[model samples]
Target: MTAIPVSAITIVGLGPGSMDDLTLEARRVLAQAAHDKQTVYFRTIIHPTVEPLKQDLPELRIESFDRLYDESDDWSSLYQQIATEVCDLALQHPIVYVVPGHPLVGETSVQLVLEQARKRGITTRIVSGLSFIEPVCNLLALDPFEVGAQIIDATNLAISHIDEVAGKIIPTIPLMIVQVYNRRLASEVKLALGECYPDEWPVKLVRAAGVGEEEAVLEMPLYELDRNNFANHLSTLYVPPVPELSALRLPETLRYITMRLRREPDGCPWDRQQTHDSLKRYVIEETYEVVEALEENDMDKLAEELGDLLLQVYLHSEVARQADEFTLGDVYEHVNAKLIRRHPHVFGTVEVDNSSQVVQNWEAIKKQERASAGVDVHNESVLDRVPQATPALMVAQEYQKRVIKTGFEFTSLQDVYAKLEEELEEIKQAASPEEQLEEIGDLLFMVAKLAGFLKVDAEEALRLANRKFRRRFQTMESLAREEERPLTSYSRPEWEKLWARAKEAIASN
Candidate 1:
């Protein structure tokens, strides 16, 4: 047998819960430690294999960190402390740290010890053994690779960010969560998974795997995960993959659907023929439908319309992806980065008093970004950021808002009204058709500017006006039908009376 190195840490893996599972190298190392009168440290002596190993090696001195578990407040810090103590002991003499299963698998203290030992410049060695994953997988009778299984620590799955839960616990893959050592941890894990998985989703609890007759597997719905008392230090939770059709809630599902719709030969012919330029009008139309849903205050309609708008975005992105210009991932990355970079008060140490200050900071950061990107910041107009393809009223309002920041706006409401009236009169007094068109355009521009000063959305106001006119005209048609007279045959007096009646009926309703 090779003599143990001085001032080194040897971590041994005690194969999952059976005396016969011990590897020859691990047994030799333990015998050597016993012969050398060195104490072997067990991360925890809570496994069925511990007693059998102790019986086999009667002369071996054993020390367990079971007391540390009861004494320490924080598990992370406790693991670090255990690592520190092991490294400190290695500095005095060679130390053996025996952990359940593989030192690298589900053993936090073992990992911590390895890291701390490396930092302290201490020589370290690992003795591999069968991890709990093998026996658990055997009991389930499924190949991990075939099922696209993912293994994660219970603690990580428990405290996973709710918003990022999709990326953490994918529903389309089988999940094996280790170290569900207590009811509390199981409960937290259940809540985290509840974000994406339904309560009726089936899952399994396996206890004392590879421990012969002591092993048990309990199949239950996800909602009952924390309701049972079968959890122990040797327990693992298995979450089967959700059905492929049920994975529609995932963003990747949308991406996949979009890509499949554009796939060659079998793809939708119309979708295959679409280009970015051809899809622009669809995007605009879907956006208006979303606005219409919002204006009507129908949440269900809003959700459906928003999905249509999202489809347009996906279609355009797929087109760009086919051309190899950029991808949906690039779009997300660019926008997410821009949001974080511009919102200094939220993401950085910069302070602000209100949203006004936030807007100021946003513009300043944008200017800095433009300068860094070699854009002509000094020569660029503020109005250049507003898209020309936007609705005419919105474009006009945006232009006015931008220019007003430079003190080019009217000083007061009276001045704004005066300018509006001036433009209106000029349109009426125009001498030629060309002059009349120019004056009318100026009048509408002035109206949009007036809307900005009055703190109203010009586009929404115009939409509301258009809706009111349509509703009142339809009411007039109804009134005309009731009186048995054609709408076109109504005299001026009769038309005035019908309009008044329609306005009153709508107001009463």
Candidate 2:
């Protein structure tokens, strides 16, 4: 209902060093703003150009928030406070906001101010000047594109930014980490980068870059970053990419694939139609294939199959997103938190002796997690987690392990054998088909228990057995064809002989 203040906001950069690097357009605007009765705001007056400009324009009422920097550890909150203050002042009078670099480059306050001003229908204009990068290139005699150099802001990093954006450091290119104003900020940058770049990798610390001949470029290992005598507002850490490594993180790529497959109007028909329920079978199938690859010691196939399995994770997360249930980040966070919580030996102060002890600790942590979530673990059955949807053999094996953990297991392997024999005899003496079925079931479950006691994965062992049987039966059939004897014409004795021959052939092969 009121007039929009679009013409009231002006953002100007003070250039890299001082007035010498300031743009002509920026200079002109500052001169006009000096006597216009407008509120002048400097992001900080620490830069050499600030006092010089104030001296040139004595009529300008200059304000600075250097106190906020001294008082707050949170840069984001500090920037928010500055933005609010600027907006409040702009509401009363026009604002000529000045920052050290280009308004959009590593200028959080500038962005926040622009956002607030836009919400009030204010028109904002950016008067460009030389950013640090310009002087840096000249000072170092380096071409940014040739080196694939990228810039990162030290103040904006968080766990949420790890792989979603520029935080995913690809070591194939050189990185220009800016705004490392102190040892603390430098340490944060070093840790965030340490995820991809090796600890001993060499990185450069360029102080007062582009300011003049006084600029210094210090080279040292990444671990020794921020250890220099001179590191302040003018400091920047340069991380040269590792030559052999190309990419660092996979989330961005996985997110891109998921987005493309689910994009509106033009996406894969099969992918678009798939839901979590529809993709469950593929997840199970891909898992088995991965197991097969691992068992066969096929590294190439294993890598490919693992990618297929990870794709299923992305697909499920995408489905969750569409349903407003969760996002990929939630999936990552859940697993990451669980890992850190359960592995107190790694992330916390708890200690362990062996992997067996680690497993015990993991199970205890799981119980605590369940109880925290209001689950009645004490009242829950031992078989509560032996999922019925899993393969019968695995379910039996899981049940056995659970019961054994609860001290309800067979006394010895001999007891297990005795139970197996009793079940077999019951199968032989079954009074009805239903009774025979029960006995057969008991026999298979006993075998599974034996497998568990022997530390074998019953499901995988059964699958291998099935594969071996199929191969031997196929060989027997092939031999029958070679003899030109139809199965209808072969006697039971002839079939037995052929089976023996097949076994012999396999052993010879």
Candidate 2 lDDT tens digits, 1-509: 22223346788888876568889888777777665645678878777777777787787777888788788777558778988887877777677888887888777788889888888776678888788887776766779888878777767652224554444565667788777777876776777776677789888888776666668888899888856555677777777766442343545666777877987769788888899899999999999899889978999999899999999999999989988999999999999999999999999999888999999999899999889999999898877766687889888888888788778988899998999999999999999999999999999999999898888988888888988999899998899899898867888898898889999999999
Report the alpha-carbon TM-score of model 2 versus the true structure.
Answer: 0.56
| Candidate 1, number of clashes | 0
Error of 2 at 358 (Å): 1.2
Candidate No. with top TM-score: 1
Q: Highest lDDT among the candidates is held by which one? A: 1
Global lDDT scores for all candidate models: 0.87, 0.80
lDDT of 1 by residue, 178-199 (tens): 9887787788789888877889
**All candidates: TM-score:** 0.78, 0.56
In model 2, the runs with Cα more than 4 Å from the true position are 1-132, 136-149, 152-249, 477-491
Backbone clash count for every predicted candidate, in the order shown: 0, 2
- CA lDDT of 21 in candidate 1? 83
After TM-score superposition, the amount by which residue 26's alpha carbon in candidate 1 deviates from its true location, in angstroms, is 5.3
